[model samples]
Structures are given as C-alpha cells and as structure tokens.
Target: MLLILLFFVAMWAGAQNALAGGGSFLTLPTLMLTGMDARAANVTSCVALFPAQIATGWTGRDLSRGAAGLSLRTLFIISIVGGAVGAVILLLTPPAFFARLVPWLVLFATAVFAYGSFLRKPGEANAHLSPRGAMASQFLISVYGGYFGGGIGFLMVAALTMAGQNVRIAAATKNVLAAVMNASAVAIFLFSPDLHLAQALVTSLGATIGGVVGARLLHHIPDKWLRIVVIIIGALLTLGLFLRAP
Candidate 1:
C-alpha cells in the first residue's frame, strides 16, 4: 500500500508539473518515506519525472523562443554545460550536508516561483534584455535545475520574461530547457549509488500517466487554483523539511 500511495503522490506531482510546475516539492517528501535521504530522494525524483518533462518539451517545441540577440542554440548549450557542472557538484556533496540545505533551497525556489507565477502582471513584458544577461541567467537557472529543481519551471518563466519574452513563449521555452537540463543531470545520476530504481520506476510510470491526464484537463482546470495549491503545498513541505532538519 505504501507503494500505491507513492504512486498517487507521483501522479499529483506530475499533474502539478504539467499544469503549473513545482512537482519536486511533492516527489521529494514522498520519496523520503521510502527510506531515502534528502539527496537520494532528489536524485531519484529527477530520474522518475524525466520522461514527462521530455514529452512536454517535445509537444510544446514550437512555442519555445530565443532571447533578444541570443540564439536558441546558445541557450541549449548553456543548459547542458551548466546542468553537467551542477550534477557533478551534487555527486560530490555529502548526504548530511544536503539534508540540511534542502529545506532552504526548496523554500527559496518555491517563494521565487510563486512570486513569478502570480505576482507579476502579464501585461508587463520586457523583450529587450541583453543576450549576455539572458545567457548568464539561463546558465544559473540551469545549474539550479540540475542540482535541486523544485520550482524550476516557474523560475525559467520568470527569467525568460525578464529577458523580454512573452508569457506563452517563456512557458514553452522553459519546458524545453527544463528537460534539457534535467537530462544532463539524469545522465550522471543513472550511475549514482543513491538511485533507488524500484521507486523510480513506479513513480515514473505514474508521472507519465499524470502528464497525459493533466494535458487533457488543462482547459478545464482554473490556473489560479492550481497556483494556489502549488503555493500551499510548497509552504507545507518547506515547513516539514525544516522541522525534520538536524
């Protein structure tokens, strides 16, 4: 029954990711209940959710866009390199250190993504940001995505919009980049000792199913309510993590 519960959690996480982002916020805690530490749970979640991310990226590829003066190719390269670096750093980090750090990381990502998702007015667009600036922003965000991606989708949306992309383009571009960065991380993690394959497989299956369901439900569900739910869940998870921290 525990495995069944985990599957349901994965399903919700997948739906949250497909609909509005913040999937990791759910997957991490549930993975922990299966006897993994914070860092291990994180690595496994990245692998488990990868397929769904790829599907989203592929389906929305046309809506993706480049920054002013920056080619999409350049952004792709940045994400790959940055994600690789972050993944290496994660492999080197001790589990105890990551356990203590994760709560704060989740809190920050959640707050930033929530702010980006709801607080910013849609009419306030900025498309003239320098390519160099956009390049730097993408690289940093990519590194974060590789290391501990909780609110990565919303983070990318915020950065792209700041770089002058429209919300629609920003959302689509983020999905593609998110998959790219996570792919780099998964490549490294496939060999990690911390990977929990059984749970990963179960979660992956559920996430894949949830992604499809979420896409079908996209038009029916109110995005505002989804964002609200994401925010509340993130806050609760953050509080729980902090309480469990040593």
Candidate 2:
C-alpha cells in the first residue's frame, strides 16, 4: 500500500517538476512516511526522480538551449560541479541542522520565484543579467538543487527568465539544467546506506511516465498560466514547509 501511494506521489511530483519545481516537497514527506530518515529520504528522492527529469528535458530539448551569455555547455559544467559540492554538504550535514534550515530555504526560494514570476516589471521580462550574475545564480541554484532540491525548479525558472529567456524557454532550459545538476548528486547518493531500493524503483517508474506527460503539456499551457502556476506552487510549498516545521 505504501509503495502504491509512493507511485502516485512520484507521478504528481514529476509533473509538478516539469510544470514548475516543488516536487521535492511531496516526495520528501512521502519517503519519510515510508520509514526513511530525512537525510535518506532526500538522497533517495534525488536519485529516484532523476531519470524523469532527463526524460522531461529531452522532450523539450529544442527549447532547452543556452541562456543569457552562457552556453548550455558552460551551464552544464557549472551544474555538475555545484551539484557535487551540494551533495557532499548534504552527506556531511547533521539531520537536525538540515531540519532547521528547511523552512527558511523554502521561504527564500518562494519569495524570489514570486518576485520573478509576478512582481517584476513588464519591461523586465526581456532584461538580461550580466555574464557573472548568470553564472553565479546558476551555480547557487545548482548547489541548492543537489542539496534539498525542493524549489530548485522554480529558482531556475526565475533566474533563467531574468537572464532574458522567455518563460517557455526558461522552463524547458530549467528542466535540462536541473537534470544535469542532480545527476552528480544522484551519483553520490547511490552508495548511501539508507537508500531504499524498492521505494526508489517504484517512484522512478511512476515519475518517468509523469515526466513525459508533463513535458508534452509544456507547449499546450499558455505562458501566463505557467508562471502563475509556478508561483502558486512555490507559495503553497513555502507555507506547507513552515507549518510542518518543528
């Protein structure tokens, strides 16, 4: 029964990630409910959902091109390196400390995404970040993606849009970059003692299907609605994290 529930949860998470980026908020709690510790749950979630990210990214590959002044190759390298750093930090972090930080991190990501999605001026939609700013933002977002990964998708969308990509392109590009960033973290987590193979496998299958579905929906959804949905999910996840925090 728990496995069945996990499959459904992973489906939703994969679609949510493809749509906007708070999928971790769902997957993390579901993993914990299945008796995994927080750290283990985080690692397992990253590992299991990774393939879905790749599928989603692949479906939108034409739109997942470079952003700002940085080529996709450069961004991929940055994501790989940053993700490794974040995975190492996660492995070293004490559970209690990570718990204390979770709410604040979600809140911060939510605010940034909100501002970028809704509050920014209309003229700013086409604004481009400096080369340094784009690289720095992507690096930090990649690190966060490798670590907890709850709101990383939204963060990437926000950063990419600010760096001059339109919303659709930003969303597609985010999926690929996110997949690249999480790949390193997944490699590190594969050896984790706490990983639950059965759970990960079930989740992976469901997420893979959902990812394909979600990627297909990308072109159908209007740009305005996409941004609105992403912002709403981020805000709700922020509230949910705060309420669930100890």
- Per-residue lDDT tens digits of candidate 1, residues 1-246? 778999999998888887877888888999999899999999999999999999999999999888767778888899998888888888899999999999999899879878876787766565455888888889998998889987777778877888888788988898899889989999999999989999999999988888888888889999989988888888999999999998
Q: Every model's Cα RMSD, please?
A: 1.3, 2.9
TM agreement with the true structure for every prediction:
0.96, 0.84
The backbone clash count of each candidate, in order, is 2, 0
List candidate 2 stretches off by more than 4 Å: 215-246
lDDT of 2 by residue, 180-214 (tens): 99899999999878678999998898887777677
Positional deviation of 198 in candidate 2, in angstroms?
1.8
In terms of lDDT, the poorest run of 10 residues in model 2 is 226-235
TM-score of 1: 0.96
- Model 2 RMSD in angstroms: 2.9
lDDT of each: 0.88, 0.80
lDDT of 1 at 108: 94
